[model samples]
Target: MISNAAKAQPRGASRPKGLETAARVRKAALKRFAASGYAAVSMREIAADVGVRPGALYNHFPTKQDILKDLMLSHMADLLQAWDSADFPEKMDPLERFVRFHIRYHLEKTDEVFISYMELRNLEPDNFDLVEAERRRYEAILTGILQDGAARGRYAVTEPKVATRAIIAMLTGIPNWYREGGRLAKHDIEDIYLELARKAVAPGATPPLTGDRMT
Candidate 1:
């Protein structure tokens, strides 16, 4: 279980009103979306949560769907920015850097991470396309890392893209079960996951991945 002492409260109504109304709406929506599925949440409820009348909510987000789109888009953008700024060691192997940086960055953002995965089906078609494109861009970063590692004989990835997806799935699943002070610390968990990831693509783990199996 994550330690209560280490956990930061999810942004909520108690926050100072210094934030712009739109920013407050985004923060409130994130809390509500994570607590209730996107389909079950309504614009009125979000407006109430943010201490605004429903009409005022429209000034910032014309529709509830617009709010959902903004939440998902900003989440992805923040994730990318966090990864870029992570204090990865300059001498670290690309794979090791990726593993550590990913786990550390996401552990601090459980709510955003949860909604990013659980609420995608609620996105409208155009919004879905926009979010998916950003997601693919982030995934491409990992794919490129795997390809580079393979070319250097550091990893035996048979399909860089497939390996990228697999590794991400494994890492992203962390927030589902992790707590701040579980039987293992975050660093210990990161190390264990890193070893599992490293071996999965190690030179002799499995035969070359097939094109059809590139899922």
Candidate 2:
């Protein structure tokens, strides 16, 4: 779990203030998305949830589609920015740092990730293409980690791309399945997935990026 102290001040991360109300709309969109999925949500319904008359919503976003597009596009931009700014210590072992990055991401932004993936089909072709490009960029980072670790002999993987997708799918699936006030704590899920991802990418033995010298 991200500490409360870190939430207020992301060192390199900031967003526009006028976006706060629009953010409320996005929050409703996310909940509606989780419950009924995207197609069922309408601009009027979203505006109502935001406590404004339906037409007032157009002042912020011209169309239902526009709001959806902004939700997705902004989400991708925020994610990439956060990822690009994190101070994961380079001195840490490769495999541990790799898993820790994903854990931190999942803990901090799981809802946004879940909403982004689930509502992707709602995007128009051009908009979808834009988000997909950003998604591919993030995927490249993860796959690069896998390939680098494999090359360094710190891990074993037959298919880095496929393995990377599996790990992401497993982690992304958590928001959809996790109960809010239920049995397991959030960190339990985090620890389980970190180890699960390690095993999936390199099973049955210890990963030794720290111990073995890198060639």
The best candidate by lDDT is 1
Task: Please provide, for model 1 over 40-122, each residue's C-alpha lDDT reduced to its tens digit, 9 standing for 90 to 100.
Answer: 88889988988989898987899989998998899899889988888867898888888888898788889888988888998
Worst 10 residues of 2 by lDDT: 10-19
Q: lDDT scores for all predictions?
A: 0.87, 0.75
lDDT of 2 by residue, 88-193 (tens): 7878765566556666676666667766887888789998898899888888888898898888876788788898788777777776677667888877776777
List runs of model 1 lying over 4 Å from the truth. Answer: 1-19, 207-215
TM-score of predicted structure 2: 0.74
Give per-candidate clash totals: 4, 0
| True-structure lDDT of candidate 1 | 0.87
